[model samples]
Target: MSLKSLGAKIFAKIVFNRIQKWATNPVETQQKVFEKLISEAKNTVLGKDHDFENITSFEDFAAKVPIRDYEELKPYVERVVSGEENILWPGKPLYFAKTSGTTSGAKYIPLTKESMPHHIEAARNAILCYIKETGKADFVDGKMIFLQGSPEMQEKNGIKVGRLSGIVAHYVPAYLQKNRLPSWETNCIEDWETKVDAIVEETKNENMSVISGIPSWVQMYFERLQKSSGKKVGDLFKNFNLFIYGGVNFEPYRAKFENLIGRKVDSIELFPASEGFFAFQDSQKEKGMLLLLNSGIFYEFVEATTFFDKNPKRLTIGEVEIGVNYVMIISTNAGLWAYNLGDTVQFTSTKPYRVIVSGRIKHFISAFGEHVIGKEVEEAMNKAISKFNFSITEFTVAPQITPSEENLPYHEWLVEFDNSPENLQKIAEFLDLEMQQQNSYYFDLIEGKVLQPLKITSLKKDSFQEFMKSEGKLGGQNKVPRLSNDRKIAVALIQIQPQN
Candidate 1:
């Protein structure tokens, strides 16, 4: 290993050791660490601007600031892009991370030097914690294949501007820079259609140990590899060690991957975005634990019960409870104060802050006025599939409303399964029953004939990956949207009638 890699390895070891000690301590110790970090962040803000000096405690800080969404920051982003200093921060942000907004087309989120460190540190700490928990650091001798978005810089008006992906890739430790599979500068995000093919070609011969990306893209790559090599995914990735996936749900794709690889690959969920690398899989055994980047951003959780209310109550890490969903709000070092990221999560446990992503606030189905979020659908589906002793390989749900007088709305399930179809109808009946049990509103609407029956389409084994690839969203960071509420789009693509 080169000097920088050796230094990074040593630094990682020290950090991992410290985290291990911290992990074993009482819950109060972790809270104290969070408290100290919150105080430091408050102090830093106060020192930079006199306006923030009035902030006293975490609660005070949260109460005094109003929650902000991405739309509210557009003007400030525009000003920064125009080369203005001190609009959002003291200086121009290092680079803008390009992200797709659910409603808006695309957004360039600015990440300053102060903010970039947080992203880097969160990712590093996640890796270190994983290594500490699993004791598999020594096994990572082969190249770490981050099936990441392209690192191409976008040019506007004769000026070449780097996106956050490009910027982060540019700043990666110099030692491991040469070892990166695709040359950073050549991997263009705008050219994903072409780059994905190149990515498969480039990594075909390399001994890849750790493969990290969104489950959708990885699934696509696996499918392509299977076809191109005329071999199963197990043959192509026989030497692969661990699979670290993020950006979307992996539960649906889990069985297919495991079966294809012929080995139980160690998997972890990463809660990261273009904005910043936030929480990650803190422990392999526990459901995704939220390791608060104490140094990066101060976090607040709005109680799920009161999130839609005008005066919702916000809770800190200490005040949060298990089994309750909350909307995450953060005040980051990047100058975004009390920003609502639109995602929803539920805490599985509080001591270590284990959270499972519930769904995005905007990404829900309200067809026939029966509100259904991603989590509820997933749970219902899980229950239904478990009854048949068969596992779901991949699935997506879309709301469907027939044009009849009832104007009813129901769900269309596009599912891929590995087992025999002898009990397919039984599976559908169980799914419908589970939906009725979980969602009262859905039951009422369906019984009243205001909603149609739930429909299921059993795909041709490995067709979901093909469908995603055809859309040109076939790599890291992108995933098959689990739920689409829009009626027009749903009708055009997915077949509503249940297959025999």
Candidate 2:
């Protein structure tokens, strides 16, 4: 083994030894973490404003600090951006993760010096933990292509500001830099379409052993590389063995990915957002990600069903139950206190505090009161894919209201196919049937003629990618919403569809 690979294996062994016990007793681990975070932040301006000194326990903390969204926290964040020190954390944050805000225009999430290591550590522990469980570490010896956002950071009030991926790219450890692909100059290109081409050219002939990115973007890169090299991914990169993805559900795109790779490789899912890196798939044996309880963040959950209510019940890790969706509430060392990140997740295991991201609390389609969500759409899509044996490259759903007396209201689907079954109508029917099975309200609407069966708009290939490119949202953690109550996204998709 080369020195770098040998070093990686040794470090992985150390991380595994450190995090193994914490995963077994996550609840206890989180409690201590929560108390420590409070103590760390209790002297800051935000803590002083909220009287954090008097808060002694989780219940006390919850009672003192009201749950806040971006709008509510904007003032404090702005102050930090304007060079205020000790306003949130002990000092000004090192950087801000500017997110593509669906609800608010663009949100700047703080990343303090104290919390930066947590972000790095959580990601490192994920890979290390996976290596420990699977005993696969030689991939570290070959090149790893990390498809990330542009590294061209912008300055705001003397602090660096950029996408979380871009910011994290700067911190990739020096030891692994030798085997990393796509030179830094190429990564600094702001335009994704341009950047992807540069990435493809730089790494096409390299011995890539690991690849990581959001699935859809990675799929695009895979297609480009395959087309250019005229080889399946497995053929192009013989040593490729690990795939790490996050930012969207991977199930709907799994079949397409498997087809492109031409072989099965180990995969890991992570739950990293601009807010924080919360969890990662620790073992191939389990479906859920082991929550990072010892990280510099404290987590709480409110039953998603009751999330909009005034003063909903906030449950700690110890109180969360399996199978119930909960809106995540987080207190982080990055200076956010009891902030609602708007993500909904369901616990799969309470003992180790493992969870599966269900959907976004803001991203649901209830235009006609049927209350369809991302999870339901994903389930229906999964079922249809299983029943029909077809593959989807990308898809999004929106409500199409009746245009007057002539047209009928229906659900509109804009789907880009990697491999389509011959009978499009049969596939559409199966999808509608699965939606009805998953949601009775939707079934009742269709049965009562309140809504027509979902209309399938088969997009010509590359339409989705073009749409994102045109919208300047083409790469790195950006995702097409799975369900929207309005036809804005659907109309845009159609407008950008490739002309036959």
Candidate 3:
């Protein structure tokens, strides 16, 4: 390693030591640390500015600031794109992280100097914690492949502006910069259309040890690797040690990933967004325990019960409870306050603050006027599949509304399975029964004649790839959207005939 790499290593060690000290502290101490950080943040943002005087306490700051979504930040984003000083931050944003949103077409989220350090810290803490648990840090020494977005810059009037991935690549530690498997500048081949081909070509020869990306993209890459080599993916990346994923849950694709790799790969979950890296799986031993970056952003949880009742109570980190779901709200250093991030999560424990991602607040089905969340669907499916002694490779549940007299909505399950089971009907019935048991709203709708019975379609193993390709969203950060709850999108997707 170079001198810069050595310095980074030393810095990482010091940071890791501090995090360990914090992790072992009492809840009271941790809370006090967070309280002080909140106070400092409030002072930093509101102190120098005349317009921000009303923001005195954290509660006052939250109450006074109107919640903002990505759309409201678009004008500031445009300013960053033009390299102008934006209202949200003091200086010009260092880079823009391009990401797509459900309603917003494509967003360019600003990553100011103040915000970048948080991302680095979150990433480092995650790494350090993984090492602490596994007693292995050199596992990353080999060729580590990241199925990242293309770093090609977009042009405005023939002048090239840097892409989000390019900016991240540029800013990473110089040691890491040297050891990056595919040189970002050269590896990220231009044109979104050719991304898969480029990725496959670049990774063919390397002894890739660790891989990171969204689950869907990694699955697609594995499939392509198998097809090209005429061998299983395990044969391709024989030296692979770990799999780090984010952007979506790995439940649906778990079996496929294990089967492809021929080993139980160590995995890490990241709750990263275009705006910031919010949370990460701190310990490898704990699957979904999210360690919140206490110093990065202040978090608030809207009580799940109140939300369903149409009256929500927002609670801070100090007030969160175990096993209760909540909508995530965040106030970040980058000028967003009490912003509803639209994701839902449930705390599994609060002593160290562990959480399981429940679903997106907007991505739940309200067919028959009774709401059902993505977590419910996942639970029902998992229980049902376990009962059948067969594992599901991939699946999606779409709510279909009938055009007949009743005009009722019914669920259609599209599943991909490894085994061609003799009793498919039994599996279907079990899944249907489990759904009713798990989601009372679903049961009530069916019993009241407001919704019809569940339907199942066994998809060919390669069907998801074809669907993704047809949509021009083949690889990198894209996933097969589970529980397409919206009436129109669900209808359109279910109506598509499976390719022969």
Full candidate order by lDDT, most accurate first: 2, 1, 3
Per-residue lDDT of candidate 3, residues 17-114 (tens digit): 78656555535543564454454444433323323445555566455555556776566556556755534555555666666666767666666667
Q: In candidate 1, how many clashes are counted?
A: 1
Model 1 spans > 4 angstroms off: 1-13, 20-51, 155-163, 383-394, 403-408, 416-422, 443-453, 458-476, 495-500
Every model's TM-score: 0.84, 0.95, 0.85
Q: Candidate 3 clashing pairs?
A: none
* Model 3 Cα shift for residue 167 (angstroms): 3.3
Model 2, residue 301: what's the lDDT?
A: 95
Residue 156 in model 1: lDDT: 41
lDDT by residue for model 2 over 1-500, one digit each (tens)?
A: 77766677788888887877887887788889888888888888898999989988888988899999888988888788888888888888899999866667888999998889988888878888877877788998889988998877899988999989889999998877998878999988887878888998999899999999999999989989899899999999999999999989999998888888899888999999888899999889987898888888899999987888987999898888998889999999899989999889988887678899988888888888787878889988888888888899999999888656777698988888875568888888888988998888899999998998987888888888888878888887788888888888888888876566
Task: Please identify which of the two predictions, 2 or 3, would achieve the higher TM-score against the true structure.
Answer: 2
lDDT agreement with native, every candidate: 0.68, 0.87, 0.67
Worst 10 residues of 2 by lDDT: 1-10
Better of 2 and 3 by lDDT: 2
